[model samples]
Target: MHLSIFKWSYIVTAVSLVVAFLYGGPSALFLCVILGILEISLSFDNAVINATILQRMSDFWQKIFLTVGIVIAVFGMRLVLPLVIVWLAAGLNPIAAFDLAMNPPADGAAYFPDGRASYETLLTDAHPIIAAFGGMFLLMLFLSWVFEEREHTWLSALERPLAKAGKLDAMAVLVSMIVLLVVSETLAEDAETVLFSGVVGIVLYLAVNGLGTLFEAGQEDDETTADTAVDKALAGANGTDTTDNPTADPSAVQSKARSGGPTQLVRATGKAGFFLFLYLEVLDASFSFDGVIGAFAITSDPIIIALGLGLIGAMFVRSLTVFLVRKGTLAEYVYLEHGAHWAIGALAAILMVSIGVHVNEIITGLLGVAFIGAAFLSSVRRNKALRARGEDPATVGAASH
Candidate 1:
């Protein structure tokens, strides 16, 4: 598993090294390395959230995530997304936008002699709208988790109350909308643009995530019906009528089906899985918005950004995701998901706030790391307590389910 995961990292490193060196000697190579490191640091929480969702998917879907999904992440988001954004914002043709990105003017003047706009300047100018969209999307994600009732919690004091409040339908969306309004009012410029982008973000989240939920719910209903039918058939085969057994619990049968291992649980495949894939991709894009903008601090070269931050850094994140899923890391560190969501909430707020102020990328990275580290420590402590009580941590986790 380690070999399979690290192999991509090694290949990306070697390729990035060669590309960076050829681009502009040692200094460029160093910059590329720094960008890669920065991407990984900023995106560690992304890997954890991805693992949480990926583990529910079938092996085939998981493989798709690592293979085809990475391509979308590296090229589609890192390369084409910028061009598309520039094209849309500056009203330039795709070719012109690409050229402007590759060769930004020295004076940073956006309008060209040929009347084409500089892609970099246009992209930079679009940051507030971009931040608002991504920020709102991520904010909704964090709120949804906190609002939903869960078995384990890292911060019960706050989480318990939030979960209770979450019982109200669409409460997450309501809170997000209110926050978006507040943020829009605070923005000095492009208030309308930011608000519009935020509305689109919320709508997309609802449409995509809600569609995935509908599919998953339908699948679960089908599985339940099938399991109930099979249980009745087995009871008949044993010369016992299901009706005769007064204590025959239908929910127990469903529970057994769910816990019966990989085959019994409906694999996230077909239409349901595809929507889930879309959700993952959207989630990833939201997470990368800040990283994409922050990469400009390192260099404005689109190729180097694609090679270092997109290729190398994103590959490692994908690899880490698979590693987490395969190792059942989430199952072991029960509070890890909570911590990741908290980090996401912090990131969402930071992204929104950054519209009015400059928030350091280092602070963002450190906040995520701090939450994750604290969660790890809490998990360790809980495991130790369980061991002292003469209980196996693994057994306890399974039983809780």
Candidate 2:
């Protein structure tokens, strides 16, 4: 609710709009505005999920996310990534890829661009692979959320059943692989490529998630050790017998406090933060894949896509994340997280479906909005019910299941 949180977003939106206008004139400016709105609508749920992670990160890292992370989202994913996909897929070097991107063939005149496919053509050709990878990764995120047991439930009938089903070992992985196999066999033309890409997606998700968990465990251990060291230092300073053994090295305990107390804890936290940041980046990339591809439908201009989706849209999402964290939006709207994950599940399904059939960007945006909107309303009702029963809504469980 604080307007200050969105101060930069407003400034960036205005600057990006002016740049859009200067770059491509009135029509381009209009399209840029439209694209920005489209990106926001498609990515509102993304902000919610982002806030869940951002809240746990230190303020320093949060600032890095807004600054350095935005640059990667803007350039790395939206601009350079498309080019890289084309380069790798077509076996073209950087120069050739950039040249091809700059000079896309005219619509419907897809003979070939100088004995090679056009930029848009190649990117479209790469959709199945993108869908396979992004879809499976997002599906894993969704399944893990849905299958986990929780005290709170948005749709108890559906969630309760899923939670019970989750007791089976590796239920999420098994279901994801089965879905990947089904899609690859039935939907994809090149089943081998789709299957391979999907498997890679699943593996990458597990690796990143596992690394994050490992780092988090290390961080906890470091904090515990530092706390013990600090306590011993305090006891020694107070002339208390902290240890049972009279021969214990008091100097050693003091050295640990002086050397490893705050410094070692900070290092462990930073390492954990780095991996969590990496996880957020990957999640953002997976979410943006469909948007990046869908942007071509509006305009074939990469600069415009970056201006709208990156500068305007992505900046807004980051600001919204800050707002959610500061305002404790998720804690208030308990079902909101469930809604975002459901939206993600829907998106994963749409991505897999688009491997064979084209889905309009409008449909993709609407489905996300619908789920989130419904969840918000449901959350409001729950709050009212709790108030009527004389229970403090804020005290209820809001775990990130």
Candidate 3:
């Protein structure tokens, strides 16, 4: 390992262990590290998107993001969230699950009977809901990618028809929910439970987005005027051709196009960062459900759950976000964001599916990883092709050579 790597690893490990010890003991500490690695691997794509946004925030907001954000992720999502779903779905009391997670011995004996996290009992009971949620998320992801082809003229034409009927978005959400309720309810009752939880999450996402957009302060930039008189004078000496009208300057087209689009894209993407952050977090949660449930396939200790999974795994995602930004991968890899968006859409569908069927977490995760991996590899190949041909890498952005 690099010397810097060793130092950061040691520090993070030491800090995590200390936190684990305060919560439970050595078992929790060990589990925290294991879960941390698992979460980081499953979530690197999330980090890339987060990095893209976080890099733009002021340091004060960045600090808030790392500190307060982690607490919300840990206590709010990891620790309490699963239990809340149990209450909302199975009619189990909220505090009952929390008390069970806290009172390890009591919950282990009475609720689980098999000596596991009571939350897992809730989830296993609600498998259909999880399957539906995951399935829907995966489906959404696939559709997003399918429609993203820039050169596909047919799709652009199809968009109008699809939009007119609201056939895509409404149909997707409605069909998935209907299937989860009608079919999964008959086959697996707990699946309905998971579906309810996912719907709640989607509602939350819509609300957050609405609020963010409402708060947005719009601004306009003054358009740049080209020095056409100076351009005409210089071009006259160089025997450059222009349109008969002096202002119809063909010579300046390249520079004007280059300047205009980038400024607009940067501004649009900057505004987009917050919404993207919300999407990424929601997407990460969808992916985490499988891992969280699967961990019960291993052990059920809440301390181990928090330490092994929460501290080590979830915490590291934050660090990974930092590393992605610091390394400047977004600037280097043009398609990384596209890959992430597609993966997110996939994960969302899979999450919806998990509510209704027994979609394996490993398969769901690999599907997302595969999508992103393909995009990244494609970006690399395109970059290498340009390099080999002695063309500027910047041409990747141009519509034509």
Candidate 4:
């Protein structure tokens, strides 16, 4: 609805057209446009998840996400990541990999002089590892969220059981590991690669998430200490026992926390924000694995892939993120975040299974859209039901003033 949110996307599309035209020709430009659209289609859910996280972040960090983060998303993940993958997989130096990307062999021809393998071929061959890693990482993210104990749930029947199961520490990680093992055994070849990559994904999630939790806990402890000291000082000045004052109103305390308390409670700052940024970048990379690989199907030209999918796609995704945050879409929809995570879970499963069996990209995109759409409709129904019951939808679960 906000045309301004899409302003950058429009500018990026125009720039991509010119660049694509100059780089190759009309055909190249057309491919660029198509790839850009594909990226957007494939990544809408990603934008939603990003908004869920971005809403928690401070405005300063949010700006950084849109600006510096866009650079990393577009150039770092889209361009450099592919090069790194090819370089590592093919044992080619970075320069050679870049050259191969720029000048890939004819459709079926091998690029290596010794007839070893083409860059595209090698990249394709690495799919199992890529899929396993990305799948596991995404799966872990979704599981952690779904299993978290919450007062309200979109899918109460299912989520309630999951929340109960979540009482066991590291339940999400344990389940993810079991799934990874099962998936690894199904791979015909490079099972080790799949297993190892999956382990790396799990470890990466634990490490990043653990760091965040540690810092958050530390911040909370510090705040509690400060608040306690202030309370004692006030009690001394008033010549009254601290306990004599009735306990502060819980709702008021919560309101204070929400408004004046450390915004760091939800969005990290300082060292924590840095790591949160890293986590986001890694998550984006995982989401992009399919898009990067799928781009090869559209065109073997890596430059075109980067221009359309990388640059243009990144812009639109960022725009969508800002739109969601500004409009308070997540809070309004209520179940939308739940649906996004469920979609993420499904995507993760599909990615892992695709290691042994190919899955259509269209199916992947549709699955996400379906989950999100269903959740949106469910939210609308819930809102109407609440209104019918003489309750304001906006006040649902909100702390009273």
Candidate 5:
């Protein structure tokens, strides 16, 4: 792997550490470093999922992802999102929310000198809604992946059946609705709030993912038209009839020309690329919801949280994403995507479970890491087996679901 991809992340880490020390001395710097490590540990699966999507994007959009997308991930999700949550949940103005975050209670007190709830308390109060929305969105993502028929199956016993069942129409949606209903009725303290938030999440996922697919199809159609035109021109010069012959199967042409299989990726451009970018940002936001909330456990200072999670953690995640795509890691380790999605499913379940009972952040981080690590080991074993059989490892496990 090239170290140059991570050069900026290293620079940012160093500079941020210095700035943290200057801002609040040794303690602040230590907290920042700790928070950065926490973010990375909790989000390793996020980097894997991101690489899968990033590989499908065009070069220009990929650059935009590293540039423009990072700003949104850092400032938008890390800094502003907390303030907004506090504002809405506490019924305060944006300025008041900012003030509240800027001046947090000392030593992680639950309330201020004025007897008002502290920033951490207010944010914690808003956890149900956040978890509901983010959980449902991630659940939908996992369900869709599970439902799709893939060329490769990581856990054949489980995935093969799921893929077979996926033949049924709207299976993913039906299952998601059932899960939401069950959770809202039995598990959630705020049933009305959970139901509303979960429905919003499901709807938003459908809208964003549906629009992306539509735009991607349009892009493919345009390309197919261009290719057909060229084919006709060449046929004309050769004095051959290029009109629809008995051998011309449009479905076969489509299946062969487009990136439809599990392992293949078509670089999306124009409006398709924009929607894909949008989808990626939303996915990142969902993944970060837990991290943002969990950061309060380390420290109540919003500035420090942002500096650590945003600058240090987010940058490294992006760098890891670029590394995975450049090195064909996803293709090499076919089960990695499966593991990442499984981690996402677990996260969604944990988020829902947290609505009724508190869950330790450490448990959450460990579960994700365990899934990813298991997947990596499974991939290694598969490669070794293929080598022993005198087959090319690259010839198998071609695409993501």
Candidate 6:
């Protein structure tokens, strides 16, 4: 199973890196590759969601997602960001920003006309950056809570009246925009741009999801065909070919012998694989958000920024993904998803507060680490208790459905 998983991951990584490197230079290509891997790892749970929803998509659409979605993400988020950041960063002109991004002072000192590092100075820019990340993550928390509650049939009191309304994700995006607008008016430190950037972040998520949805449609159609075929095959008289040979490749005969285990395994694998991919990407983006702004405390070369952070970050994310999937770590950590949701929420809050309070990226990272770590510890304790009582985890109390 791990061998198969590794094979597939290799394919995904290889494909993503090739694309990234081809579009951008070594720096960009490396950045994309690193980010892709990072995103894929952190969002394994996201992959679970993706697989479930992707069942609705067409194969063509899925291809579009693999191809087009990556394009938008790499260029829109990474390449174009410097220019945009420069424009939004105070009175710094595009050239000045590019200059700051590309060429630092020869003396490793502040080189701007004001004797302060213009672009160099921005390496430590926390407010605008954190605001975007924290704001979006907070929005994620709100959406998760609202959606989770909407599904609770036994608790009418806990259910929202808005549950009867339109999509919660869409609503969250709108609300985020409004919040940005309000926060912008109050927080004069690049408030308008931060609001604008927040809108961009939301749009990027939606666009990625929209593409994912399209792929899901393709999958839905295939699933329908497969189901129809299975029904017809099952109903056919003396047609036992599909069920024969548990370990053998039954290509020559209509055998009757079959193992139920393999079928269950296939279903489980498919289900797990889908969600794992989605969760990895979502988490990847989350991690990147935490890293990007945080990178400001370092150098400002978009090239170096992408390279330094991307390489180390990407490797770590991939390793983590492999560990979780291969090691069946999710089975061990019941509250991982919960922690992710909370982390997303905390990051969003930190991003929002960054506008006024200048929340540090270290603080943001620590919050995520702390929330997830706490949830993990809680899950372990709860699981240990369940084991002591000999209760079935499947049937026992787990927060998630």
Candidate closest to the true structure, highest lDDT: 2
Q: Give the Cα-based TM-score of candidate 3 against the true structure.
A: 0.67
Span of 10 residues, lowest total lDDT, candidate 1 = 392-401
Best by TM-score: 5
- Cα lDDT for residue 246, candidate 2: 45
Screening candidate 4 with a backbone cut-off below 3 angstroms (N, C-alpha, C), the clashing residue pairs are none
- 138-245 in candidate 3: lDDT tens per residue? 444334344444421122345334444454554545544564455445544564455565466545545654544443323123211234444454454355744434
What lDDT tens digits, residue by residue, belong to model 5 across residues 178-285? 988988888888899999999999999999889888988987777777676545544544457546443455555445446443223457888878988898898999
Model 2, 285-313: lDDT tens per residue?
Answer: 99999999898888878889999999999
Task: Determine the backbone clash count of candidate 2.
Answer: 0
As a whole number from 0 to 100, the lDDT of residue 287 in candidate 5 is 89
Q: Over 4 Å off in model 6, which ranges? A: 1-84, 87-99, 106-117, 122-130, 141-146, 149-171, 189-191, 238-286, 298-307, 394-401
lDDT value, residue 124 of candidate 3: 67
Question: Against the hidden true structure, what lDDT does model 2 obtain?
Answer: 0.87
Which of the two candidates, 1 or 4, achieves a greater TM-score against the reference?
A: 1
lDDT of each: 0.85, 0.87, 0.58, 0.83, 0.87, 0.52
* Model 3 alpha-carbon miss at residue 59, Å: 4.4
RMSD, every candidate, angstroms: 4.5, 4.3, 7.9, 4.7, 4.9, 8.7
Compute the lDDT of residue 70 as modeled in candidate 1. Answer: 87
lDDT at 47 for candidate 5? 94
**What is the lDDT for 144 in model 5?**
95
Question: What are the per-residue Cα lDDT tens digits for candidate 4 across 136-243?
Answer: 999999999988987568878788889999999999999999998888887637778889999999999889977866776676677777566555544544556446
lDDT of 6 by residue, 84-193 (tens): 65566556776666766676766556565567655655644634664574466447544544455432221233334545443444666666677777777777477656
lDDT of 4 at 162: 93
* Displacement of the residue 290 alpha carbon in candidate 3, Å: 2.6
**How high a TM-score does candidate 2 get?**
0.88
Q: Supply the global lDDT for candidate 5.
A: 0.87
* TM-score of every candidate relative to the true structure: 0.90, 0.88, 0.67, 0.88, 0.92, 0.62
